[model samples]
Target: MIDLAHTPVTSVPGVGPKRAEELKKLEIESVADLLGYFPYRYDDFRVVDVAEAVHDTKVTLKGSIYGTPSIRWYGRKKSRLTARIDVNGVYVKVVWFNQAFLKKKMKTGETVVVSGKWDAHRLQLTADRTWFGQESEKHVGRLEPVYSVTSSLSVSWLRKTIYGAFAAFGREIEEVLPQKLRSRYRLLDRARAMYYLHFPKGREEGVQARRRMVYEELFLYELKLLWHRKQEKAADKGMTRRLDHEKLDRFIESLPFPLTGAQRRVVEEIVRDMADESRMNRLLQGDVGSGKTVVAAIALYANWLSGFQGAMMVPTEILAEQHLRSLKELLAPTGMNMILLTGGMKAKEKREALSQIQMGLADVVVGTHALIQEDVIYRSLGLVITDEQHRFGVRQRSKLREKGETPDVLHMTATPIPRTLAITAYGDMDVSVIDEMPAGRQPVETYWVKSDVWSRVVEFIGKVCRTGRQAYVICPLIEESEKSDLQNAQAVFEEIAEELAPIRVGLLHGRMSPAEKDEVMRSYAAKEIQILVSTTVVEVGVNVPNATVMVIYDADRFGLAQLHQLRGRVGRGGGQATCVLVADPRSETGIERMRVMCETTDGFEISQKDLELRGPGEFFGVKQSGLPEFKVADLLEDFKVLELARADAAEILEATDWEEAPEYRPLREYLDRFQKEQAKFD
Candidate 1:
């Protein structure tokens, strides 16, 4: 197998020294790197000769050039050249644009063919030559690899270098899948899967090969995850605290509405783990609006009630602020300090908060990554909870644990994972799910609508904002772009502020300084801003219960779980909230995806559906979570394999008493290298 980390791109036979540097510009560095650089698409140009062209028929014609190209320059930087060829008494016109070299290269009366929709031209047949090349055109195939390239490197060269690597080192890469599973899945041998996918002669073959590879990726990812889980769970031998139902019951009853059965189940599971002497490392899986926050709050509050300081870490200042509002309300009667800490606060203010925290005046401290700062000391940190746990890498979570003298960890994610995948990726932690919405939390009326429906929605938002209800308008991009249809955060901000001039408009996105973002969020939380235009940066953070409307532009661009999270941000105040999915329905694919979001709001069910629709590796967002990247597995698609791997890993770990087993030597070595790689990612 090619070790891409140490091997240079020039080592690939065909890539030579000159092309190797150019390839580096594209971030392609080695054999393993090139192998994963799959084609964006396949362009097929296999067809018959042009002599059989009908009057207005569309067809692909491939043949040798039969005539000399004449250069025709009209205006500034304008050019055109045409070639005439006779084939079976039919004269065909071939036109070229700006190919000055072709004028001197081609000889008249050589047999050449061109392809496009045949058109009638003043007593001659004519067609635009969209498909043409030299000798290569003569051997058209069922599938042609179209590569993404810079001007310095040609597609043919890339294809050749990539092809050579696969041919030479393909078999060297180990097959991670067991034989029995491979046969059951009907997957091709690992080498064949790579070869066929890269250079298949036919479309069907390419599809089959790609499917096998994709399946392998999903399966292996799951296995690695489950393996990680087993090791973590097995290593957990520390004492855990229990604050049972009495504490949880009080919080639940204090709420205006009753806790959903799903919420109760998760809370009970949390208490169960806390009661055990072993440290509780658990993941709370819930969808947007699944009431995960309340359940998490209960765990933190329980730890505090039992005389331990609890810490809640969120990904963004906006989310941290949001959690603070909800937790403050929930822990109000409990008289917990419920202190807040974020990177955005004034330096002096932060210092004071730190002083209070060190003084142990803050029982439950909530903040973003600031909680993990080396200078921020904790007093008896017993529990650490991270919302949207995927955003933080494994070591980052462990770092927070270090702050609390090895605090019992609780990781929370609103992203729903399929059962098999969960066992693989989060296997180390026991799973608790908040599957139900609290009773009387009106389901946000959701819709996947085109731009035409927005005028009324905007008016409605204006009305809602006027009535003391806040609205969130989420744009897909942070700023304007020439290449995408999703409105930028800035554009949406300007548009909304213009549309509702009377209402105070606020903007929040990833690009803002943490302090700037915090101020905007705090203003929104205070209801100083009536309408907030934001990017998905606000997806996990920024809780404004009085905000009753969520309008996500380019809604189709987001995955189901994410859209659910954004939707969950609203509907927090118990009053009815509306989730409007504004998207372009011009494309059937875009419309179909949006329809799924509108059809059902169940996060777990949607997560499974998303895996089926978009594959497991993409089950989360496209942004790679800072984990060791796996080349052959996906957590979503290969859940079963994950379960098996996790079980096997646990067995091996237990057998060795956590470090004694010979079987774990290879895995331990891999993990050590992987940990270094993860540091680079950080």
Candidate 2:
């Protein structure tokens, strides 16, 4: 048996260098890659009797050519080939468009099979695919796989190439799962499953093959995650800290507001993890304004009491500053010395901060990626916290953790993810969610309006402004593009400023410098700018309680999660707030997104809907979130299979001698190969 993973696609009989280049466009560089490239759909070509065919439904028919086929050219490169077929003594008109060569192939008394839509009203059959006598025997009785191909590669050619590859290397394809596991899951053999996946004799067989592939993909991923978790625990010794419950209770009491029940539960979980001897890697997730900051502050304070320095990293400088201010206020009673470090800080300020950090003077340090730079040092770093954890890559988080001596890490995200995604994306870490919001916070009132009602929305914003409350007018684009029809922030700012006189509208976008953005945000927060027209830069960590209304233009252009996040910017104060979504959505998906925004404010529910609509790849971002892309598994549709695979993977890992046992040799070998392949990219 050859090593398929190392063999190039050109090894296949018909695939030359040029053909291999075409395959490379589909990410099929290796024989294994080509085999893993599953078809998006299957075309059922099973023969059906012409008399039994229904109107407008696709059916395959076997018949004899009753007369000579004729071709009529109507225009350049366009022609219609018409013929009559006799099926059981019944004559039916068959039409083929742009297939002039078929006229020469079909003759009187010739047998043929055609798959197409049956038009009962017109008493005709429109053929999409045709097979001459011998070819019909191979295709007319089974489901045909349809591969997604570029224009240079036809579906027929790709299908044939895959079939040839399977015929040549079918036996060489190793079964990664052990025999006992296969029997327990009722899965087909790997080689058989691959063959049936590409060419199934029946629909049931195709479904079974797909199920096997999905389970295998998910099971391998779960195994890798669980194994990493086990390795992390075995490799690193964590700091065990005293809880100091009395000190922590006093610090919590010093806060301006009380913690929600969910926050208290998550706090207890984090404290317990900190008290344990093992390293803590926990994810703290909650909806916007859910007091995650307070909980994080408590954790940092607890770490301070444990007599170690704690560091907090955020995605942006603005968010870093905001956290510094809020945490300072929350933990002021503890007399914990905190320092700020960021890329935008001046040379003198940064030097002083770095010196303080190295001298152990900075008890709680907060900053952006600057904290992870080589120059900064922590004297006794014990706990690491990253806010908006999805925004940073895995390596960045790891770098921050590496700065300490096996420090306990807490990842906090305002974006609430569904349980299925949590299980897959953050499988290596324990998860804690703050599902409750603080008291006195009201649900933002939401409404969907068309472009024709723009006047009314502007008037409503003016009314809100007159009452001394602020509003946000969000656009999808920063500046006008000749190619885009969506509203831009600059243009909308001008229009709204004119429509609502003396409302003090200010424009903020990504194009602005950090200092300029800070100034604009400061104005908005101080009530100097009543309406801030901006792009999606305000989607995260922008808290302005006085902003009572949010009007988003071209809301259809944004995803449900984004829209929910944008709406969260408002309704933070004691006053009732409203969100008006202005969109003239043309597609059903866009319309449905708008409707979902108007229906619910639950971040988790909206995220689930977003996953179903846009899938996991776009939920946050596959690459950014360190999510693995699977060939046959769908995180949304195949969630139950994922759960089963996760459970099985955990069970296998629990065995004391599974790694060295002969029964798990196949699985162990596959994992070794998988890790080596993964290391190449890393």
Candidate 3:
């Protein structure tokens, strides 16, 4: 009976091997996969009158066909089925393109229900779905789940197969949550939740079912994270360092700028962590120009003073070089030896860097992934730092630690995350946020304007360039293609150059070779490129304090955190900076996003709004983030449920040994199975 989870999808009624192949495109190969496959949205198929249909909106209406749908041929092979429907003296033409077979199902003066978009241009309804004779009770006047599909699969068929599967096997579906916990939370039974999630009677029941399912997903994820943290704590035997406050102060005072209060507080936190016997696994999160690098340097300096080596890994060669140059200037004055190692370096140069690191002659080494190579050994490595923490996964981070004897790890990200997101994404490590910007750093004045005003923005860029300031023009795509309608960097660069002749514009994109990209970046850094047009590749540590303007075309395509990062590229030089968002959003949500971007430069506040607007999957980028792929949970909408689930898991852990307890057998089994499934992806 337990093998039902892996039963082939073809075993379901009406789903043969051919249909199973189509389902496989959706990652639904087994019964369990089919069950877990969820709808992206729902369509309200409640009955209404044809006269009440809103233009350009999807609606369902019941009416009598005035005559048989006539099949007409056009453009050689194209066919259209056209018919007329009358309801209470209102007549509307209904059309279905390339669906000539639909004409066979309809006859003159027949009662039928159709759901589709009502187009006002032709005074017609484009019928994408129809129910013959009488509306089915299963769908009419109810909330209908709309599954995402491939070209070969239909939502109608998929919905029917799911309903049939539930009728056959719903009772056999295991309840992963313990009965006691479910009762305490007032959650519906597992079988009931499953039924309502896919075939709800109304919006209220649908929301309730979604809440319960989301709680289960978050609860499982939280348990796994908490368990991992517990294990790490049990195994920790970290460095216990004694710091020289006088030496640290001398290094801080020698810096070109004074440290902000927030920076000082974070440095103190690091010092406390390093002095403890347990390993320091902390995440340092801050906004752009919040001075996180300085805090990292202070920690590395403290490690150096304790007679140990330190290493910092970045994601790109340019960022590694930038860090090397900055750290050399800052730490060398205090007699610290810092060396740069990158994959692009000559073989002989890399050999020398590795030799110094192995010989303990180099106090600090900064590089890209080259620092983690097998040949580059550290003699007494006591500290490891990874910048842009999201770029590296858990196992890759562990590989860096393998170089040292479980050295204290400090991960850094400039991405300002919301509170609930921080709790879940970085549950395994302690988090410290530098919420305050350094004194004297100017907030970039942001504006959201229509794309039609490109000429005005270009004129403003020209003015800023004449003042000896640089600018960036970011596009969502690298190049235009037939597949996408978005504006691209290459075309925008040409347009900008034509509009503002002799402005010395440069084009940069991810498709360029490393050498090409580096050359373009060098030009921009030297103030040679007055207007640099590029993609989000420039969103990271491309620091040019001279750049004062950022013009993001189609800015609505970006999330709030991304917009903030792009905005951070400017306002680094302490003078006035501006971020112009050129966008013409179609949806209300898209317009609201632009409003949020223009309202404030407070990253945390922006992040909260972003989380609220776009659910966690989209806000955090489901593909890139370490967050789990949930079937029903939404980090933004179900935050309260997440808190409760976390508390329940903690209570369960403390109450008994869940592995051996009979009441927790189902939970343990589910977790074990989940781990096994995750291992396949790992």
Candidate 4:
């Protein structure tokens, strides 16, 4: 087998230094990368009789040039070449734009083939590609791969280069999937799949090739994830905690409201994981206002009952303070020592907090990334919980985990991921979802309105505040930008403050300092500010029960998940809350987003819709979410294949000697190379 990874694209025929640079723009530097660069779409150039061809449809015609092609120049570098073709007694007019050079190639009464869209109204065919008599037999009547190309590259050149590479190395292409597995799945071999992927005989062959490639991509990714999980489980010895059922029952009973069934189930799952001999790496996913914080507090209480320190890391200091306050209130009956540690804390305060954490006096510590700092020492840290886990990178989470001796890590996120994303993105960790809302929690009434009804929206906000409740006015931007026409927080704050005089309205944005943002949020939570005009910074953990009205301006500017999160800030209290989406969307996608938000409050459904509309790259932000960018597999469309790959990977790893078995040697080698590539980025 050829070493495709080490083989340069420059080794291919017609690929000089300049051509190699152009190929690099498409991220194809090596022969392997070039082979993986699948076409986005294909153009069918099957020959068709002129009489049988439908007008206004793309068709290829094989015929003899009836006359000499003539060229007419209209402007600089602009010319039109017109010709007549006779296909078995039927004559058709053909035109080529800016191809004056074709005049030399188009000979009178010469056999040629053309592919283009035939216009019935104009009685002409606008030819896109032309080939001579014998060449047409090999080039036409097949699916031609149309690649995404840069300015310096042409589709024909890329196709020819890929063909050349295949001719040289096709027989040497190594298979990564085991023969038994491929037979079971009825998948095409790697070399055949690559050929059919770029140049297929029929649509079914193309589909089969694509399915095989997608499955292989997802299967390898799943293998890597499961392998890492296995390594971690074997490397570390987990702490098996002894649960105090009596104290846990008392704590549950002491809550103001009864636990939801879903909450209870997830808590039980977590407690079971803590008591197990295997270290727990789990994801706790819940929608906004899903009472996840209370569940997390209970988990921390359980850790305390086991006589171990627990650290909760949040994204922002404001969220950290909020968690500290809420955990303190929830754990008040047990007298657990909960302390706050943030980067903004004073020198003396930081020192005291650090000393308490190191001395084991702090039972439940809530803070931002400050908890993972080098100087901060933990005394018997047993559990580590990260809120809004997407905000932190893999290394940051690892740093926090390294703080303790194989601490049980629980990742929490308010962003309810779709099942497809949850399985793939968090494939390394076990996932627990709190899908139920607490009893008596009201759903926020949502409405969509255009900007022409801004007056009515403002009046509604005023009426909501007049009833002794708070409101939130969300804008997409903090300040006016020359590029965007969307409403900004400062302008909206000024407008609302003047519209509703005597009602305190506050402005909060990311541009504000931490202290300033925290002060604004504190005042809003205290009900001193009847209306808070802010950006999506309040989309995560800001909880004000009195804020029953949410008015979002330019709602189309935000994604469906973000809009849902913003609406969740309201409807947390007993009273009926309302969310008004003010938007004048231009595109159908924007309009659909608004419609979806107004239609339902289910974050998972909204997330699935978001995944469908924005795709996984934007939904989970592959760069930050640590999701691998697949070349052929789509997280939404190819979810079934992903499920199969994940299951198959698990079964394969269950075999103790699979790693050493000759049958699995190719997969092992591929995984070894993949890890080395990943290590470079790390």
lDDT of each: 0.73, 0.90, 0.86, 0.90
Model 3: colliding residue pairs:
none
Model 1: per-residue Cα lDDT at residue 193: 78
The TM-score of candidate 4 is 0.91
Q: Kindly list the per-residue Cα lDDT of model 3 for residues 206-289, writing each as its tens digit.
A: 887887788888888888777667666778789767878888888898889898888988888988888788899999999888
In model 2, where do residues sit more than 4 Å from their true spots?
A: 1-37, 50-54, 66-71, 75-77, 86-91, 100-110, 132-135, 148-169, 245-258, 342-352, 373-375, 393-396, 479-482, 621-625, 678-682
* Candidate 2 local lDDT, 529-594, one digit each (tens): 999999999999888888889999999999999999999999887778899999999999999999
Q: Rank the candidates by lDDT, best first.
A: 4, 2, 3, 1
lDDT (tens digit, per residue) of candidate 1 on 289-366: 777777888888778877789899888876776688888887788888887898778899899999988989889889
Judged by lDDT against the true structure, how good is candidate 2? Answer: 0.90
**Residue pairs that clash (backbone atoms under 3 angstroms), model 4:** none
- The lDDT, on a scale of 0 to 1, for candidate 3 is 0.86
Worst 10 residues of 3 by lDDT: 131-140
List the candidates' TM-scores in order.
Answer: 0.63, 0.90, 0.74, 0.91
Model 4 regions more than 4 Å off: 7-31, 49-57, 64-79, 83-91, 100-110, 120-123, 148-158, 245-250, 343-352, 393-395, 481-483, 678-682
- Report clash pairs, candidate 2: none
lDDT of 4 at 482: 97
What lDDT would candidate 1 get against the real structure?
A: 0.73
